[model samples]
Target: MAKANKKDDNVVARNRKANHDFFIEDTIECGLVLKGTEIKSVRAGHINLKDGFARIERGEVWLYNVHISPFKEGNIFNHDPLRPRKLLLKRREINKLEKNVQQAGHTLVPLKVYIKHGVAKVLIGIARGKKQHDKRQAIKEKTMKREAQRAMKI
Candidate 1:
């Protein structure tokens, strides 16, 4: 089988607010432990990562508050819309994340959920909460960059 292209990943959902509200320091791709109906719903773009987060509990990384809408065709077999899911990560990586997260203001936020080679995966970021002033500065910088690009195009 041919390998999937990096740019061709089928993104299920994204948490735009995560970038705006947090200063992302690093990103890691990890697999998700999802059920049949849950994967189906994800493939249908019924997932929401807006309020999703990950935490290390009892030596395991668990994803919380991710909403994967129920599959339309699924009746009793439909999975719950919001359920705490397990994130698959290596022990060393988990330890690193756990350590970094223990620092003040640091947290794990799901950046995006996507399908790679027919497998469900999530891109999670190790981030620190941004202050209101930092958010405003980011917004100003973004606006200035946009204007600069527009000027160059003219």
Candidate 2:
């Protein structure tokens, strides 16, 4: 019975700037704790992860700056657009992320948000900030790769 789902099929929102601003060393999929109205908004693809980042505090991961627009029909029970949401992960995984983030220049960034099997999940990355030169290098490499692909097509 159940049909297989392809990657990116259920992606609701993505932080495209995450890759350009930082180098993602590792990523972990974690569940999100959202209110009923928030979930409704997410299902409608009204979420933004552009300025989102996660922090480990008091042994729990809290996501900040991700904007989940309120449900249009949820007049009285609408959730705040910029509320900090809790991220669910195993204790071991949380510890690992905490340890990595303790290193200088490293931080946690929310990469994308998607619905999997009716549950909302977030892909968080352990990233290190990229310098100006590093960002330029990445851009250059991307342009070269695109040009190469065009040449191959010709």
Best by TM-score: 2
lDDT of 1 by residue, 73-97 (tens): 9899987788799999999999999
Best of the candidates, lDDT:
2
The regions of model 1 sitting more than 4 angstroms off are: 1-8
Alpha-carbon lDDT of model 2: 0.95
Candidates in order have lDDT scores of 0.93, 0.95
> Model 2, range 44-154, lDDT digits (tens) per residue?
999999989999999999999999988999999997899999999999999999999999999999999999999999999999999999999999999999999999999
lDDT of 1 at 51: 86
Candidate 2: where is the Cα deviation over 4 Å? 1-5
